[model samples]
Target chain A: MTILSFNNIEKHDGHTIVFPSFQLSIESGEIVGLMTSINVRTVLLEMLRRKIPVPDQAIAIDGKSIQQLGKSYHQRVGILSIDDGLYERLTVKESLLFYHRLFDSKLPIDGILQLTQLEAKRNVRISKLTFSEKRRVHYAQLLLSDPDIYILEEADQNVDLETKRVLMKVVQELQKNNKAVFVLTSNMDSALAVTNTIYRLDEHGLHKLDVMQQEMEPEDEAVEEEPIVQPVRFEKIPTKVNEKIILFDPPEIDYIESSEGSSQLYIKGDMYQSMFTLNELEQRLLPYGFYRCHRSYIVNLQKVREVITWTRNSYSLVLHDQSSIPLSKTKMAELKEMLGLK
Target chain B: MTFSLKRTLAIFQKDYKDVSKNMYVSFTVIVPLLMAFLYGMQGDMGVDMVYTVINMSLSLVGAYIQCSLIAEEKEKNTLRGLMLSPASTLEILAGKSLLTFVTTILVIVFSAMIIDYQPENIVIVGVAIALSTLFYIGLGTILGLVTKSVMEASVVIMPFFFLFTFGSYATLLAERFPVLKAAEYMPNTQLIELAKEVQTGAGFGDIWSYLAVICVWIAAVFILSYVTFKKRMMD
Candidate 1:
């Protein structure tokens, strides 16, 4: 499957054309690297901005015109800018939540928090954090959004060798999951590390180079330890699009069946309240916090830090981070009774 | 929830953070507050203090803030990060201008409240501050686009700050010397309009005229700055 295809893509900036004509595409489950001089970074960024669909000619994706699928293209396409695009005021978690809202779905954020190894620093402001730490948060954000086509600009610029390998492993994992990766690298070595197909964007235009198949031949890595297996292939399995939306599975509430025959808990944030269905959630969370706080919602008593009285007839729940969730009139008394707050 | 809003908020929050930590933050918040007090104390200070501080608060401070923001980001190589997002130049400018406009209004309110100086038409005063700040922020953004460092932002902005202080000569001359009528468009013009509106309860017609002038300036400068920024992005 062709996840991304750019044909005869030209970009102009009033006076002069930045990219004259470019043609490129990445196969499904392939990680292609784009190597170019540092001078081209600004122009390339402009190309993405203007989305100059044709280099004065033509550009398309999966045979559909780029002009037709413009913003739609962006839905599955994520661009990692030259600077990591970290909001300094946002703690790592807030940053993730902010981007999560854009995906039109609430994500299981804790996994990404842990995957990026920023859990310990989750609460710290990004501005006060170190460069590498900030970059980690940046990468984590890109991952959590989970785009099928990720355009990474200079992915290996500031990290250590160990971290670079970890990032490469991540790209491999993404590729294994059938995501097409477009990497712009100034370092040919870094570009060669993760890519089978490589291209160069230069004065002429974008040139698709032959795959560096010499060293990457599959048979060369035959180790006695185990067969170096290729990634699993589902022939004609269809792209992630036209496929069912996969809800991100996060850790579910783990609770023992209470001897008292009911489990009540507190889970805070408008985030959870919106994601869980009151009735269906009631069945799944019977052993947990699925206590009917009101007709509109349920609460996990364990997650609540305090109950805040909003007004004479209204109240809000204050959770761990001081984030509030509204309680319906009926839910409040039930919640209060459950907590013996009356 | 669309990409643009997410991107816009990201830009907004990021710029907000950058400004909050700026050493100049104290100057922006404190200078207006302090000078507003000084303007109220006509015993030791004269109307000149009122003119200079109030003028600078509404006009120069926002420009300085915008200039400093661009310079700081350029120094950190962070502007390139924002340019690469899938947002149009208008969206970026909208977010930035909104931040600049809101912060500028804060300075205006602070100065107005502390000095016991009220505008003839509060709405016109609002329109004036918004237009003037928008104009100046656009101006400051152009300065930021042209410069290399945050400190350089001060150099470009200081002359205007000084003008609003000494530019009163031009205003005094405009009062008596018809030859100085040519200089009315200088920094003194905005201050004179504001002073007239504040003291004499002038009609909103003048404020509207001034706002139109400021709007034109903002539009011209914004287009120029955007072109410059875009050219830089293509570099």
Candidate 2:
């Protein structure tokens, strides 16, 4: 059995703290969702990769410190990050073969291909595959390794609904094998869809969020016909500007950018510091037409005046104020469809 | 951690397959043979030209191939996958170096054959070439670690290539400018000097210092490259 724990883990970037005294434990057959803010998700992933040394055996795997497990720890833990680190030139079969050889595993290639639904794509070079197909290839590598613990870092982002379904199926299979899975994501809906136990990470530490009991019950036929509408709340966001606290209407803000681990809100030709992270702000302001266009910038869709094509794959969003924000290449088509731009 | 030959060989096999499909790597191999053929056509394939070709093939071409391969992995972000694998650092390093070493040795030997150059003591020349190959491969790995992309690697490695391969002739100016004497300690310079010693039927005892110097250079370069690589991996 595998047991992964974080006991009072603290991580700081210079003077600002990312994770402050967080404690959690995950065991085999359990899938835990770590709801991370957008600003700190990348930092958290980097910390996890380094396996930051925890005091008093705070972080342990299988009753042993990861440091003690040494190089062998990697064999037991598989990581699937947003990058999907894959060799683009190699065909799907060759890529899988290379990883199989690395682990020296006797697992059959056919089994992995079937599990990932990539049997037809086995001969295609990874460069020619779609984004979703590439993600499945990453999943195939994970399934082939069959690690005891799987770390999914923003696995559902930039992927289509079908791909998300396939990934959830893989997670279920992993759970059936009694493997521990830790999912770090900013999307609460996606996180709640996979795991009942959710931990919200914030300034104080990780807090358990109570899953709504209504979600567990089957909807009545009458209720299905008349869906209940959620009340829209447009709260004034509190921001800091030059040590002064200010409350600004959410709709007035043009966008928010993460600068030096803090969110900067652009409003009315001025910038103000926001205490809420980009992830928190995104969730709060999403109802007001705010969309996360890039890793660092969240643009107010209503404020976008034009979409400029910088290159065949690169794009930038120009706001009404003449300020520009980067648009992710993968999100371009979706943005165009949303804007009704043919 | 125990060193696993099986894992190392697996990496070597994969790298061989990958390199075979890479046009840049293929060109690196052919460039040296082309140079050798040109020299053979001129019918002036003397010991000086032979040593120069060996040095160029092992140091210049070896560094280019090794650096580009590693940098390409970094560009594609696949190095992190390898680093996060169960393979130990030694296994990965040895595996990568083994491919470069074998390819470089084959090129060196083939170039020599084309030039009809035969050393008086084959064993001595082989040892020198082997040590030189290790040194150049180490240098290449260092270059790869320091470069962020394959384009940057190609640009950054040019100075080192010229400095090492052409720097041996600095000995000609050593008589007039004593400052140039330090160039004799460079790996390529030692390789050329050792090759000359072997051509004149020098034994192990006669060229032991040159061998020692080359080995020291290799060790120093390997240590530096390993330290930088580990640092980059962690970051």
Candidate 3:
């Protein structure tokens, strides 16, 4: 059952458009993740929290319009934002009991403490707890609310491995109770680790991410020498900004450099991290006027304005942005042959 | 909007625990009682001296404490958590204000007792004190909503604190400076005036104007606070 949904929603700040129209639907007993930037997350969370009022039919809870449901809609949907904001002076049990009464939740306090694995810390003040332990108190508040749909914003961010495990376990527990969970995060790895139903939202639109392909990457590399699978060509190179995957067209990239065994794509002075190694990126970008000018660099031939030979052993390729990339002495010969310049 | 005593009391109880543990805010409740005791040592307490202590309580225990509590919520971003909870706006505001309200009244009663100051008309003075507490709470709410942190709230509340706590004394200079005459209309000044009238055995009908002036301040401050609270809710 679809517990919460919003469709064709548009948001703007003054004359600028924040996010274009998009639709999202979360079904019961499922966990979904949306990957986007912090700016987009702020806009999206506001829309989901119903702070930014949409048109009459834009948002719905339990298949009814949110405006019609009014404040009662909040009871069905609870948002666990990055800021847990627990009272620092209160004990864990005291804080949980307060929310339990506020939301009129029937869940026992001990049950919540056990679920979040804070039973030992129940008597500890929030000010005295660890960062992750405080986050567990946040999860406990969510359980105390016991809403049918839980909207989590970066629930796994900046926590220890144990807290991450506890968060995942809590989501699984919610799914067991047939509750819907929606996670909004900028970290692609966090999204993939939490659930398979992940989507990436950007200025373009919302696109479903293929988690199967992502998980199969390591296996694909392991089986590469066997040649059992055919080579697949991709025109768009995927790079990441703040853990969000952004697919960039080959023409938009100025150069690619390998740093610490990972590929970095440069475009107009801004660096974006790519998951592909330098060799893989070189192979994929070769047809798009790109050449491996150095062991650590691949320069786009179209953007190369000048090739400076400082010495017989030292060479550089200068692009239109006035940024120079190193050119290997051997690859200098290859570039000369490709450019038909002796 | 739904009203739940269970939820309100839960918030009240939570705030009670929170305030008791926060020495920065909880210790402020003792200021007025201490002031009253010092005045009692000097001999019979005048109505102005008694009101001086009561007005200090209104600004300190009422406005300053309420402002710190709400600002602390915003500072820690806990206000958003409460706003998103199933509890209604009324429940949260009433629940929070109830603590400050009770504290303000208790301090006022203690200050009155410490100074051996008795009102000829307890009903009239009680009503005035209650209205004045509401006014201070409303003022505190507005300050809390405008400032993002408790530090900012303390800074922003300085002028108002002086004006509300000592604004009544501005009337002492009203004859020297014609512009200072407006201070006579301030709620704290009206509170002082109301207490004086009641001491002279004035009935509700005899002192209705002073009560009405304080009521006007309450209505204006509450309206602004409610609007500010609504705006902050969206933020």
Can you write out model 2's per-residue Cα lDDT over A1-342, one digit (the tens) per residue?
547887777778789888788878898999999878876677666655664545656677887877677787888888888875787778999989988888877789998888778899999998899999999999888777778889988887788877788888888888898998999898765676578677878655777754433344586899889867768763778775333345666767898999989999986556778888999999998888989889988999998999999998899999988999899997898887887886
Docking class of 3: medium
lDDT against the true structure, each candidate: 0.64, 0.82, 0.86
**How would you encode candidate 1's per-residue C-alpha lDDT over B1-235 as one tens digit per residue?**
1436665666576567657766565466678778678667764444456556767775467777777777766777655544433455566666676677778788878776777765556766666656667777877788878888877877877887776556766757776888877666654465456656655677665556655665666788779988888887654
The residue-by-residue lDDT of candidate 3 on B1-235, one tens digit each, is: 7689999999999999999998878778877888888998998867888888898999988998789888898899888788788788788888989999999999999888888888999988999999999999999888877888878887887888788888888899999999999999999999999888888888989999998999999999999998987787665
How well is each residue in B1-235 modelled by candidate 2, as lDDT tens digits?
8888888998888788788887866877897788899898888666778877887897667887788878888888887888788888778778888889889999998999998888989888888888888889989999988887888988988888778767888998999999999998988888878888787788999999999999899889989997997798665
Alpha-carbon lDDT of model 3: 0.86
Best by lDDT: 3
Q: Judged by TM-score relative to the true structure, which candidate is superior, 2 or 3?
A: 3
Model 1, residue B35: displacement in angstroms? 2.2
Flag regions of model 1 displaced more than 4 Å: A6-24, A33-59, A64-76, A81-91, A94-109, A125-131, A184-342, B1-10, B42-48, B119-124, B174-179, B187-191, B205-235
Please list all clashing residue pairs in model 2, or write none if there are none: none
Superposed by TM-score, candidate 1 places the C-alpha of residue A112 at a distance from the truth, in angstroms, of 2.3
Q: What DockQ does each listed candidate score?
A: 0.10, 0.48, 0.79
RMSD of each: 24.8, 12.4, 4.9
Candidates arranged by TM-score, highest first = 3, 2, 1
